[model samples]
Target: MATSSSRIGARLLFGIVLLFPLTYANDNAQFPYALTFGSSTLTASWFTKSEGIKAIQFPVDSKYRAYFEDALASFGKRIMRRGEWHVMAGDELVPAPPDTHNEDTAVSLFRDAAQQVSRNLSATLGFEPTYAALTLSSVFNQSSTKAATDAIFPNGMGFIHSIKSLNKVAPAACVAHRLDLCGNLGRTPAECADKDSISNLILVLEYEKEYLYVDLVFVYSEYRTFPSVGHEMLREFGEANREKLLKSMSTYDYNRKLHQTLNAFIESLVERQLIVRVDIRAIVVAGGASATAIAQLRKLAHNAVGNGVVKVVDEIDPGLATAHGAAANNGENDEEIERAAEDENIDDDPQSGDPKETCNNDAIEYIFDEQQPQTFDGDKMKEMYYDKDAWVSGFNSLMMECTKLYIFADKYSIPQLRDDITSALVGHSHGWGWWPDPDIDIIELVYNNLPSSSGLIRLLVLFTAYSWSSSPNVIAWKDRFRGFHPEYLLDVLFAQAQLLENEIHGEGGIPYDGMLNSCVVHEHLELGEEECRERLAKHSYIFASLLSACQAANA
Candidate 1:
C-alpha cells in the first residue's frame, strides 16, 4: 500500500512540474537591446560583450542593435565635419612656426671670437681682431650706420672683438731697486718678463655698437728709479702730481712695451680707426687693485680719453683667467669673486674740458634713491655692482652692459649675478616709469635667446605689458603689440587678467572694476574723467578682441 501511494504522489508532482515549467532568468536579459540615453544609447552588448562579438553571436536582434549603431556612427560623422554645433571640425588647426632669432648663430660667433682673442694674445702684441666674422653680423636687426635707429643699438652686445695690451715689462722703480742692490744691473722688458711689469690685457668690446677701450696704467710701488720725470712731477705737486705721473707712464708704457703687438693688430679695423684715426668713445678703467693704483689708473684713463670722456667701471669680473676657463667649460666659481668699486669722475682736473663741472668728491650721485649707500669713502671707490638703483639714470646706456653681464653670469653659472641684473632691470623700468620707450628689439632678443628657466622672461613680459598698456598713440600701440611672440603675448594677456581679477576681488577692491590702472595706461591717458573712462573702455575692448585675433592669426 505504501509503494503504490509513493508512485501516485511522484506522478502527481511530475504532472504539476510539466503544467508550470520553472525557468532561470538573468538580470541583464531585461535590459533593452538598445536603450536611448541622450545622443548615445546603452545596449546590452555595449555593457556586456563588445559590439563586434554581439553582432556575430546575437544576429536575431540585429534590428535594434543596428538602429543604435547607425545613430552612433552618424553622430561621430557629424562631429568630424564642419558644423556650428561642434567646437571644432576636421583636423586640429596647425600652429605657426616660432620666429626664432639668429641667437644660436650669434652665440657661436661670439664664442669663436673669444677663443680667437685668447689664441692671438701669445703671437701678437697689438689690437688684433682675431675673428673676422665677429663684426660680420649687424648688431642691429634693421639699422645700419645711416639708419636713424642705429644710434639706439647698444655696443658690444657681449662680444670680445679687439685685444690691446699694456706691455709686459719690469717697472723702472724695480730696476732701480735692483741696481741699488747690485751696481750696473739692467733688465730689458724681454728679460724682465713678469718681473716688475704685469702685462694686463684690455679687451676692447663693442659697447652700444661702439668700441669700449680700457685705458690702463701700470705703476711701480717699489723704490724710486733715479730722478724720473714722473718722480720730478710728484716732487713738485705732491700726491696729485704723483697720480698724474703714474697716469702718464701708463700711456708711455702701452706704446713702448706693446709696440710690436699693436703693429701686428693694425692691419684691420684696429688700424684704420681705433689707432690711426683715434675716432673712439671714452676710455674706461676697471677698479679692484690698491686704492692708489685705482686712483692713478683712473686719472691716466681720464687723461687719455680727456677728462669729460673717461669713465670708471667696477671690478665686476672675477679675473679674466676664471672667465677664460668658464668660456671653455660652462662651470661655476672655481674661485671667489674679488670686489673692486669704480667711483665717480675725478673733480678739479686742470686738464679737464670743464673744470667747473667736477663734483668735489668721487661719490656717485645715484640716479634713484634706491642707491643711497653708494657714497665714495675717501680713496676707496666701493659702489655695489648689484645695486638696482645705480643703473636708473643711464638705463638705456647700461642695457648692453647688463646683457653682457647676464651672459657672463650664465656661462659661469653665477646665479647671484644674474639675479642682481634682474633686480636692476626691474628697478630701472620702475624708476623710469613702466614703459619709458625701452629698446624692444634688444629686450625681445634677450627674451627669445635666454634660457627658458630665466627670470628675465617674466621681467620682459612685465615691461611689455606696461608698454602695451601705455601706448601713446594707435600706431605705437599696434607696433608694440605686434612685436611680441603670440604665445608670450597670450601669457601676458592672461597675467593681466589675473592681476585685474586679484585687485577686483581683494580687500577694498573696486566693485565691477576689472581694469586696474597700469602706470603706462594712466600716464598715457592723462585726461578728464569722462575722456579717460571712454578711452579705457575702447582699449579694453580692443585688447580683448586682439587676443582672439592673434590666436587665429598664429593658428
Candidate 2:
C-alpha cells in the first residue's frame, strides 16, 4: 500500500523488522539522540519483560512511528556519530552501522556510526552510546572550567561520557552553566541569545518580533522554534554581518532625547502600518563615504527599514574568536595546535628581519594580480586588531578547532574533512589551517582514520593535489563556479595557475609553499590598488547579476 515516495522508507522498516534480533530487548529509542536536530531510533536489549520495557515501541515498522512510540523525538535530522553534516540525498551509498534493516545503506551513511549502544554489545539499551563519564557539579561554575575536566568527556557535553552510562537521552546540562569553569552551568550554550526585556516596549507594531543578539534570529525569525523542514522563513542564521544591525536598532537612550529618537525611529519603521504593503526582503541601508559610516547606516536603517540585524567583525582576525572558544573547550587539545605553530615563521612581520623589506601593501603584492595591500595608517590601524601574541594564540588554537571540526566531520563523512583531521593529528594543516601546503603526514593520518568510503574521498583530494589539481572534474566545477563569483574566479585562476607553475619541480605553487605565500586569500586581490579594485568590483557585479538571474528564475 506504500506510494512511490514512501516506498523507500517502507522497505527500510521491513528490513529492520526482519533483522532486529528477536532475542534482545526491544526497548524504544529516545529523542535528541545526537546533536542532529531530530532523530528517533532506540531499542532495548532482549530480556524478560520484568527486566526491561517490553515490546517494540511501534506495531508497524515505520521510522517516525518507531521513534514516536518510544517517546523519542529530535529537532529535524538524525545524528549518526559525529552528527556534523547530514548525508545528503545524492551522496554515494555506504553502509549504516546498525543497518537495522539495511535501509540506510541505500541512502548515504553517517560518518561516525555506532553499531551498538552501551558496553553490553548484548546491552539492554535506552540511551547508552558514546561518551566516557559525566561529573555533575555542586555549582555550575565549578564544572564549567578547565580545572575540573577528566580526559574523557560526557555525551551531553558534560552529562554522560559513554553510551553505557544510561538509557534514554537526558536533559542537557542546565541552569548554572558556569562560564568560568567554561561550562554553561547545566544548560547548553546555543549560538544566540536575545534581550527579552526590550520586546514588551516594542510591541507597538503587530508582526514585530523581538531580537536581542539577532544572530540567533537567523535560525528562527523570532525565538519560536520553527520546524526544521518545510514552511520555514529563513535559514537558521542570517548573513554573518546581520548581528551588527540588531544592536544598533536597540541603541537609544531610555532617559531623554535619544530615547525619544529610538522610539520614534522604531514607530516610524517597524510599526507594521508604515511599510505594510512593501515586500522588500530586507531594508537596505546605504551610507555615503563618511567618518561615521557605520553610525550613519544605523540611524538611517532604523528609521526606514524594519531593522534586520547588522553586525560588523573586526575583519583582521575574525578567525580569532572561533579559535579562542575552541581552545577554551576541554574537548579540544591545545598542545598539538601549539606545536604546529612553533614549526612556522608566519609571524616574522615581513619587515623586522629583512633590512629594508616592508610587509606593507607593496610587499604583499606578489600573490594577487598586481594588487597591493591598502596603505594602512592611523585610520586603517584603528580598524584592525593585530597583535603578534594573539595571532600566535589563534594559530595555536587551530588544533582544537580541528578537534571540533573532527567531531562534525567524522560524523558527517566529508572526504575533505576527513583528510583535514588526519593531517592535523600528524601536525599538518587541514582545511582549518591556511592552506598553501597542508600538512602531508597529518592529511595521511586523517585518511587512515576514515571509514572506507569516506577515506576514498580523502584520497581523491590527496591525489588531485599531487596531480596538480588538473583533475578534469575539479577544473570543470571550478570553471562553473567562476562564472558566478569574482572571488571564486580568483581562487580558481590561482589554483590552476599554481598547479601548472609547480610542475612538480619548480618553486611557485609548489606543495610546500607554507601558509603565507599559499593561502587562498593571496590570490583574490591583486597588488595594484587600481587593478584590484577594478577586478573586485567587476567580479562582485557578476556575482550579483547571477544572483538576480537566479532569483528571477525562481520568481
Candidate 3:
C-alpha cells in the first residue's frame, strides 16, 4: 500500500497537471462566449481577456419560432409534425430522415441556431470562441423545459447555475470592465458598494415575437432566489400590431405582469421562510426591452419593493447581460473542476466506512450498551425528515423509527438524543403537514413506550387537539378518541379546552407556533440556554440543543 506522504505528493502532481492546461489557455488566447436564447431573438456575446466584450443579435427562424410557441402552448408536450410510420415487410425498421420532426427536433433546432450564430460571431471577430455558455428566455427557464434545455446545454450551463456563479463576479466591474463603459448616473456603483447589506433583483425583460419574457432573480449576501419561485413569466401582446400599437400595448402588458410577478415572488419567499419583504433593496433591469420601458419599470419596481433602488444596466447593451454573465461564469467552472479533481485524490482509504452508515451503527451500538454515542448528526436526521420521496413512500415507517429512537433515548436517560428526535418529529410534521391515520399509530407508539410526562407526548396531544378541533370531521375524531390511551385523551381534552378559551379571548389558533419554538420542545434542565445555544451551533441542528456528552465522548 502507498504511504500517506506518497499520496499527498501524487495529489499535488495530479492537481497541477489537471489545472495547467486551463490556466495556460486562460492566460494565452481563451475566448468565452454566452448565448441567450430569447423567444424572438438569439443574443450572442463573446469575451476575450485582451480585446474585451462584443455582442450581436441573431434573428430566429420562423419554424423555430413556431416550435417555441407551440411548445409553450401545449405545456411542453412534443408537437408532432409527422405522424407515426411502420415498416410493413422489412425485418428491420427503416431509420427516420434527418429533417423529420420528433421529440428531439426542438433541441436540434436550438443547437443549429447556436452553430449558425457561432459562425456569424466568428466572422465578426475574425476568430472562433473556445467555450460557449447557454441561457434560455424566462418563458423557457422552467421545469417543463428542463429536458429540452438539458439536451441543448451541458450540466453547468443552465441559466440558474450560470447566474448563481455570476453573482460571485465583482458587481461594480461586471458590466463596466467587459464593455469599457460606466453607468451614466453612477447608480450601479452605489448599488454594488455594499452588496452584503442589500438584496438586488436582477430583472430581464426580453421582447419576443408575441410575448415579453420577464425573468427575475434575487441576490444578497449568501441568499438567492429559490428554484421554484417562478423566476420567469410571459406577457402576450399582438404581433400583427408591432408597429402601430406596440409601444402602448407593450407598456400596459409589462406593467401588469411586473406587479403580479413581484407579488408572487415576494409571497413565495415569505412562505418558504427564506426572506422578508423588507430585505429587497434594489432592482437592476437588463434586456432589449429595458431601455424602452425603463421609466415604467422603475416606477413599478419602487412601488412594489418599497424604496428599492432601480437602475438600468445600459453601459453594455441590456440584452447582452445574460451572455456576459455566462462568459464570466467560465472561470467558476474551471475552479469547480479543479476542486473536484483535488477531492478525488483525498479520502481514498478502502477501509473507511460510509459516514452515514457509521453514524447509524454507532448509535445502535451505544443504545444497546447504555453508553453515550460519539456523535449525533442532526443534519442526517433533518435530511431524513425533509426527503419528500421517503415521506410519501413510508411516512409511518419514518415516524416509527424516530419514535423508537426517542423511546430508547428516554429510557437510557439520553436527554439530548430524545430532544433531537422530538425536534425532528415536530419539524417533519410542520414541513409535510399532519397525516391522520398514521399519526394515530405514532400516538400509540409514544404512549406505549413513554410516560405522559414526556415532552413528545405533550406535543402530540397539542397537535392532535389542534388538528381535530380545526378539522371538518371533528365527529370522526371524537369517535376515534375512544381508542386512545386514557391519559392521552385527557391531555387532548384539556388542550382542546385551552384552544377554545384562547379563541374566545381572541388570542389563539396557531399551536404550532409554540410547539415549533426551540425552548418549548428542548430540555434545558441540565444545560443552560447559553450552553445549549453553543451546542446547537456546534452540531448545526436548527431546532434542538446538541449533546454535550456526545461531543465530550468524541473529543
On TM-score, the candidate that comes out on top is 3
Winner on lDDT between 1 and 3 is: 3
> For residues 39-81, what per-residue lDDT tens digits would candidate 2 score against the true structure?
2222211212223212121112253334222221122222232
Clash totals, every prediction: 12, 68, 0
What is candidate 3's lDDT per residue for 409-504, written digit by digit as tens?
A: 675466765666665555444433343232667788888888778877876776666566767777756677677778778887787787787777
- Best prediction by lDDT: 3
Report how far off residue 281 is in candidate 1 (Å): 30
lDDT of candidate 1 over 1-555, digit per residue (tens) = 000110021111111111111221121121112100111111111011111101001111333234323432332222211111222234753322322223343344333333333343222222222211011111222111112111111232111111110111112112211222211222345634544332121222111111111222222112111111110001112233434555767746643333333223332434433232132222222211334444444444434433242233322221111111111111011001011112433343322233322111112221122222223232222132112343322344445445644654554444434544554444343332333334555566666667645655555555555455434653556666686666566756765665567566763322222122322212221243344344333322222222212222221
Candidate 1 runs further than 4 Å off: 1-394, 430-435, 467-475, 507-555
Q: All candidates' TM-scores? A: 0.25, 0.21, 0.41
Regions of candidate 2 where Cα sits further than 4 Å from its true position: 1-468, 474-484, 504-506, 509-555
